[model samples]
Target: MPIEVLPVRPSFVARVIGADLTALSPAATAAIGTAIDTYSVLIVPDQHLDDDHLLTLGKTFGDVEPPRNHRVVQRLKHAELADISNLDANNRLRAADDHRRLDSLGNRLWHSDASFREVPGALSMLFAHVVPPAGGETEFADLRAAYDALDAPMQARIEGLAVEHSIFHSRGQLGHTDYTDAERAALPPVLHPLVRVHPVSKRKTLYMGSHASHIVGWPMPDGRLLLRDLMEHATQREFVYRHAWRVGDLVIWDNRCTMHRGRSYDDATHPRDLRRVTTKDLSMLQPA
Candidate 1:
């Protein structure tokens, strides 16, 4: 069957169908890459991909990020994949007091994956192996549209500004501050442009998210206030797309141009497991 790209929103997201992700041809891979660049989010439904298959698909884009090494957090055995589940190492439901579960609560806040890192993430591909019966949707905000919607004056004001981002800052906001000194030292804050231009399409996008602590060189209180304001403007209902997940679904998004958050679910009662692989930005890999 020929591949099909169906738009899910007037701007930024699409549902890609008719291609088998497990065994994609070089031509198919190229087409999918083009589609992802054009539509920042691509939803491929009814795809039953194991961890191996998911990682293989991620490699087509760029180097997959190794699983984050949190000092006290336990991750899946494989270093390449991140487990986005509520289950413990034994595959049993985690206790309410579990640190892993507490850490994951940070996901409810809007964020672009790995934005706090020196080499920020480019793309994130998540495969839903199991889903709850209700309320586990992932919401994405269209930063590209958000940028276009800003007033000329507001755009001009932020043109040359940059922001400092840190995982500690974001998780601390959610009251999940159990990071050891070592862990905090390993993830020092990084600076990125407040407005970034897409490497391929050349479209500008608002790059601030929950990970963004404050604008660089600005007064702390004022920087935080401005960050809050921009976040509010960029996530207005008109620029958002909420994706309801299904088992066997794979959703890939461009982290560089969008912000996303996972909605609440009954994790204690319902099992919701999703595996994610993120690719590093190609620009970061290029030698100066």
Candidate 2:
């Protein structure tokens, strides 16, 4: 059967059927690419993919981002595959006060993946290996739709503004200050337009996320207030989609036009294992 794209929500997410990502033809790969541009989020069910298969599929889209400097090295075999689980490198559940677990708590805040990087991220592929019985859902907000709903005055006010982003700033929000000097140096603050124009769809999108620190030229307090206000407005119920994950499911989302956050679960009791592979956004070169 041919691949099919069916909308899960009226605004942005869709469920793709009839395609196996591990054994995709060139045409099918192109079709998935087109669907990503049009739908922004695609949920492919029953995909039994391993690390190698995940990395292979990620390369088909663009250059996959490799593991960066961190206090604990990623336990995944490949540097390109990110470990998004609540377990330690030994495959055991982390302690309540583990530094890595504390740092990862920032994922619960709504943010775009790799938006703190200078090049940012284009697409993200997150596959579930183990899912919790309840909770642990991911919620995505459609930035394009949120932008469209903004009043003309608010849109014009942020039209040419630039926002500085840093991964450290985001983790700091959760009182996570255990980063090594090397880790801090590896990821410095980067600037990007507060309002970005989506390359393929040509739609305007609100770009600020939890990683965003402040408007480049605006005072810190005022910029922070404006960012908080925008986040509140952009993540309204009408623009959000909450995804309940299942094992063997692979979810692909365009980081350029959406922000997502992981919901809380009984981390101490349940194991929710998911791995992510992100592709760099070459189009975001020289963020202005």
Please give the TM-score that candidate 2 achieves against the real structure: 0.97
Residue-level lDDT of model 2, residues 149-240, one tens digit each, is: 99999999999999999999999998888887888888989989999999889899999788999999889999999999999998999999
lDDT of 1: 0.88
Residue 65 lDDT (model 2): 81
Candidate with top lDDT is 2
Q: lDDT tens string, model 1, 165-235?
A: 99988889988899888888988999888998888888988998999999988999999999999999989
Model 2 off-target regions past 4 Å? 286-288
Instruction: Give the Å shift of residue 210 in candidate 1.
Output: 0.7
Error of 2 at 170 (Å): 0.7
How high is the CA lDDT of each candidate model?
Answer: 0.88, 0.91
